[model samples]
Target: MKAIFDDRQWHHDPKHFMANGKVLPSPEQPERITRLRHGAEAAGCDFIAPKDAGLGPIAALHSPEYVTFLKNIYTRWQRIEGAGEEVIPNIHPANRSDNYPKSAVGQAGFHQADTACPIGKGTWEAAYWSAQSAVTGADLLADGARAGYALCRPPGHHAYGDLAGGFCFLNNAGIAAERLRASGLRAAILDVDVHHGNGTQGIFYDRDDVLTVSIHADPARFYPFFWGHGNERGAGRGIGYNLNLPLARGTGDDAYLKVLDTALERVAAFGADVVVVALGLDAYVGDPFKGLAITTPGFGRIGAAIAGLGLPTLFVQEGGYLCDELGENLTAALTGFEGA
Candidate 1:
């Protein structure tokens, strides 16, 4: 499979994030690309730098104002007298429903959902390229490639249309799905990230063109503690189109595969023309999160089952922290899909 990536993605290396009420070194770092590159090479995948498709593809899913905020937030934050090294939101409006803040600080809180996504000097550029990679993959699929992989760093499923969170900024998977929809194909995004793909879910929450489904650790007691639940079916025309299958913490492969079977069944029933796998290896047993226990071999089985859907597929990288097995785990999934 063709793996789309750009070296610019490494520039947004964040140093820290807020966790456990303290600032700690960020797990989402530049080194992640090196391991992923090794794995892609081991799988015999060809690497291609993304051709710039510009803001049009991204604007298809994100709001114009929000996009502007992401591009200019860092510069705006620099003017603050005592701002930290990176721009992290400290204040959020009590009523997000009726008020929009004009201060850079207020805008930061408004646009960034949490401390997990910190905007630094190179964040915008890297995020821009990461999104372009996803768009390029969609272009490849639209032009007739049966499958492709977008090795997007600064992973995006956690980003909403107007909010950045969980190390995600631009909602790359959602942008790819929008590209598919513009081509008149019904598309579906199946997010297998350890955390719920709240951003992707919100983007298509009221639309019928793209079906969004996620299987992750239940949010009631997990990272994204607000959105993922069994009853969050889509609203209006989108009702019955969105599905969330939250599993218990410490669940393993057999249980994961079973839930996946049900997720795929929903995709088939939806009659989607293409599928975007929001691929995240964070579910691996060795990952730092430890929310799930999917082994290296288990990823192969997951990939094989997704391949069985028999539809055009785009694999978009989400989250997988540093580990000795990072490359091997990625290689296993691609190899599994190919063999299947």
Candidate 2:
């Protein structure tokens, strides 16, 4: 399999993350690229730097205003007399439908979904390349590749069309699915991240062409505390196109595979020509989030199960933070898919 990546993705080194009301160093570190690259290599993936597909592919799913904010907000925040180094929102509107604000601070609040995604000087460049990597991987699939992997940093399952959250700036998986759809392929995104893909879900929630399914730790008491319930069966024309299978905390491999079987059935029923695996290894037993307890071998099984769908697949990196087994788990998943 071919893996898409860019060195610029390492430039967005975030400094702050607010968890449980206490600020700490961010877990979405540059070291992640090193570990993931080594893992992909171990899995026999040939590396290729992504071509600059430019902003058109990214704009396909993200809002224009939000994209502008992400690109210029860091500099605008620096112009403030007493602003912090990173652009983290301290205030937010009562609802997203409220009026837009002109002040840099107000725009930060309006565009940023939470404090997890901080805009630093290098954020825009890194995010742009991360998104381009996904686009490149999708292109490879469209051009007749059996499988491809996008090692996206600042993982992007939690972002929305206009709101950034959960350390995601732009939705890489969503962008990849959109790229495939534009090529006349029926795309189905299967997000196996430990957290719900609220951003990807929101992007295609009202459309029927692309199917979105996410299996994650239940949001009832997890990180994304909203929108991962079983009842969110898409809206309007997308009524039956969306599916969310939330698992209980600490659930392990067997249970996860059982749920994955159901998700694959739904994808097959959709008659999708391609599948985008929003791959997140954070569900590992030793991961910092401690959401689900999927062991290293469990990831291989998960990968093989997804491969059972017998459709072209693209694995776009999402979560999976720093851990000793991070790379090994990635290798296991990809090798399992290839071996299958």
Candidate 1: the clashing residue pairs are none
lDDT of 1: 0.92
Estimate, for each residue in 1-340, the C-alpha lDDT of model 1 and write its tens digit. 9999999999997876887899889999899999999998888789999999989999988889999999999998898998888999888766558588689998998988888899999999999999999999999999989899999998999998888999999999999999988988889999999999999998899988799999999899998998989999999999998999999998999999999999999999999989999999999998988888899999999989999999889999999999999999999998888889
Candidate 2 residue-wise lDDT, 26-116, digit = tens: 9999998999999999999999999998899999988899999999999999899988999999899999889999999999999888898
Query: What is each predicted model's overall lDDT from 0 to 1?
Result: 0.92, 0.94
Give residue 239's lDDT in candidate 1 (0 to 100): 95
TM-score of each: 0.98, 0.99
> Which sections of candidate 2 miss by over 4 Å?
none
Query: Candidate 1, residue 250: CA error in Å?
Result: 0.9
Clashes of 1: 0
Off by over 4 Å in 1: none
Q: Which one is best on lDDT?
A: 2
